[model samples]
Structures are given as C-alpha cells and as structure tokens.
Target: MAERVVPEGQRRRRRPTKQGAVLSERLIIDTALRLVTQHGADALSVRRLGTALGADPSSLYRYFRNTDDLLLRLADEFIGLAQEGFTPSGDWRADLRDMGLRIHGVYVENPQVALLAAHRTTGRAHETAAVEKILGILRGAGFPDPTAVRLYHAFVDQALAFAALDAAAQALPTPAREADEEVWLSSYGRLPPDTHPNVAATFPLLAADMRDSGYPFALDLMLEAAEARLRG
Candidate 1:
C-alpha cells in the first residue's frame, strides 16, 4: 500500500468538513454575544438564537447542553477578549491598572453582556486561563501565591462590580435620576442643621459629586486599600 499525502489546504478544508453535525461553536458564541450586546442576556434563548441564526433550535444542542451552558460560553468569550488584548509588562502597578481598565472597557462597551456576566461564575477554560494569567503576573511581581490570589480576586471582583454598577447608573431613566435628586432635596435637604452639622456643612461638596466622580473614586479607593494591605 502506498503512503497517502494530503495537501495543506485540502487538509484544513477536510478537517472542518469532518465536523459534520457539530455546530460552529465559535459562530454560535459570537452570535450570542451580539444578541446580548444588542438586547440583553434575558433576550437570549435557544429558539430565538436559532431563529436569528436560521438554524433549528435543536441544532444548538449539538454544541451546548442548555441556555446556561451557552451563557457560560458567552462569559468565556468576554473574558477571552481581555486575555487576548492584555500584555504583562514588568511593572506590576502599570500592568494591574491596564488590566483593570481593560476589564472596565469591555464591560462598558457591552453593558447588557456585562449585566449578565459580571456576577456569574463560569468555570470554563478561557476563564481559568484568565485567572491563571493574573495570578502569574502578581506572583511575578514578588507576591506570594496566597497574597497574589487574594489581590487578584479582589481586583477582579471590584472591577466587575464597578462596571455593572456604572452601567446600571448610566442606564437609569432621566426620571429616575431626577427622582434621586428629589429624594436628596426633600429628605437630606430637610435635615436639622444643628443635629447634622457635618452633613449641612459638606452638603455643597456632597452635591457637587456626580456618578462619574463617585464610581472611579470608589474603585481607586478599593485598589489603594488592597495595595496597603499587601504592603503591610
């Protein structure tokens, strides 16, 4: 029997073709991402996605077991973007800040997706890879494994929390933001000056603060606290 040789192009084509019944998981994930970005996580369903994709709903079952599985994959896709774009330089502060801002950028870019993925845990490959990379970066900066993991989790949690909260605050209707002001004016404005001296004294300064100022200030405070703890 003669040996068989397959051309590079043919081999590549055949490889994909061989995945007969298996759906394009990547395509499905990308479609899911767009759907979540445009509508929201609640807008996603197997049937709806199939209708949007022009495939039978059952066809998605070949790739994902259920909507939860699909959601997990979507989370992976979001984290994967961060991992792909992040480059670790030797400077830990610069590197960590870049990483935090990158996570913020991704969530801010896709608010709906951020809403769904922020608090959920998806023990997927890309998510684990992201975690490992963060740990590696911190450890490379001379932090012990326990310290690195502690800071890594805190950094990630705070970034995502701020991202979600920031999105929600921005998405509030005009009436809602206005209503918040009404409460501030009616309730806090009426506080007895003698009883609440500090509140009255700083009322102007407090009122001067906006959501834009508050979220980043809080996130920076959290980061600073973490650094102090690590230093001690």
Candidate 2:
C-alpha cells in the first residue's frame, strides 16, 4: 500500500481544512445580526457582509437564499436575545411586565435591528420559547388555555409594536434628533395665544423629552392592564 504524504509548510500551519473553512449557518446569521444592529437593515448586503467576513459574497448564498432570508435570521436573533433575558417566576403579571421591559431593553440596545424584527414573526426558537414561557406563566396563574394564548398574543404584539416604533424614533441620527427638536421649537414658539391656548400654555411640556418618558409609560400602562385582567 502507498503511504499518504503531507505537503511542506502545510504540515505546520494551523489553517483550517476546506471543511473547517466552511462557515456555519449560525456564524453567518451571527455576522448578519451584528451588521444589521450596527448598520440599518438597508446597510446590510451580501457583498458587504462577505467583505467584512473575508468571504466571497456568493458564499452567503450557501447559508441564506437571499438578503430577506438573512433578515429573517436577524429577526430571530432579536427574539433570541429576548428569550435569553426572559425569566418568569410563576407570577403572570410580573412575568408579563418583565417580558415587556426586557423586550424593550433588547430593542433599545439594538435600535436598528429592532426596526427590522419589530413586526415580523418567524415563530423561530427564541420566539417560540418566549411564547411558551409567557403561556406557562399565565397558565400557572389560573388562566384557561385559550385565555393564556390570547393574552400571549396581545402581550407580545403590543410590546413588539411599541418597541419597533420607539426604536425607529430613537434610531434617528443625531442630526435628525436635533432637527426634530428644532422643528418642535419653531412650531411651538409661534403658536397663537387665543385659538391654541392649551398649546401655547403647555408648549414646554408638549415639546419636552419625547423619547424616554412615553416608552416606559406606555409599557407600564399595558402591564397594568394585564395585571388587572389577571386579578379579575
């Protein structure tokens, strides 16, 4: 039998074999996740991701059929983050609040990615797990199965819808924030005294910090309602 021979220089190199060099679907998804989070969804493209990963753009096709496919994975990443953060301690109301706040925090952290994942539902692992957790909490609290499912839908949908809008608002560039403030200032500064009495009198509050207060306030209101339902 002939003995196999090793090539020179290759014997000592730590470079991965062709099989090892092949990236996993997870790796590609992870790269796309970070890219979308930092750069808006529009900023993500197979070519750019390929360039960043030092692989040919076509290599991405091996993992994702197209950019939309990659986006769905990115959306799953957000759900994964929410699942990782979720912890329900058998208290339905508290669990729902915790989930809502956690989801909000996840979106706020990756505002750009939040915009992409906000409304779309892939029913992937992270999302499915999160739903199961919520259902478990509701069921443990004495709700019927159908009620638990309905509550789960409302809770997750409201949280995500609000998160998407909030993130899109917050994700605006610095110049955009400044411009928005300037527009409010200009518009409020010119309000008439009689016809828009309330507007004129409350211009300061009307134009006050629109980002932080409203988001948490809205979340609190939803949680409050959920708690009330559970109590009833």
lDDT of each: 0.72, 0.73
Of the candidates shown, which would achieve the greatest TM-score relative to the real structure?
Answer: 2
Model 2 C-alpha lDDT per residue in residues 35-143, reported as the tens digit of each score = 8777877667877787666666665665666777677777877777776845557666767787788887788788888887778887778777877778888788887
In candidate 1, what are the lDDT values of residues 115-138, reduced to their tens digit?
Answer: 888787898888888788778788
lDDT of 1: 0.72
Candidate 2: 10-residue stretch with minimal lDDT: 1-10
Q: Model 1 — which ten-residue stretch has the worst lDDT?
A: 10-19
Backbone clashes under 3 angstroms, per model: 0, 0
Q: Compute the lDDT for candidate 2.
A: 0.73
lDDT of 2 at 107: 87
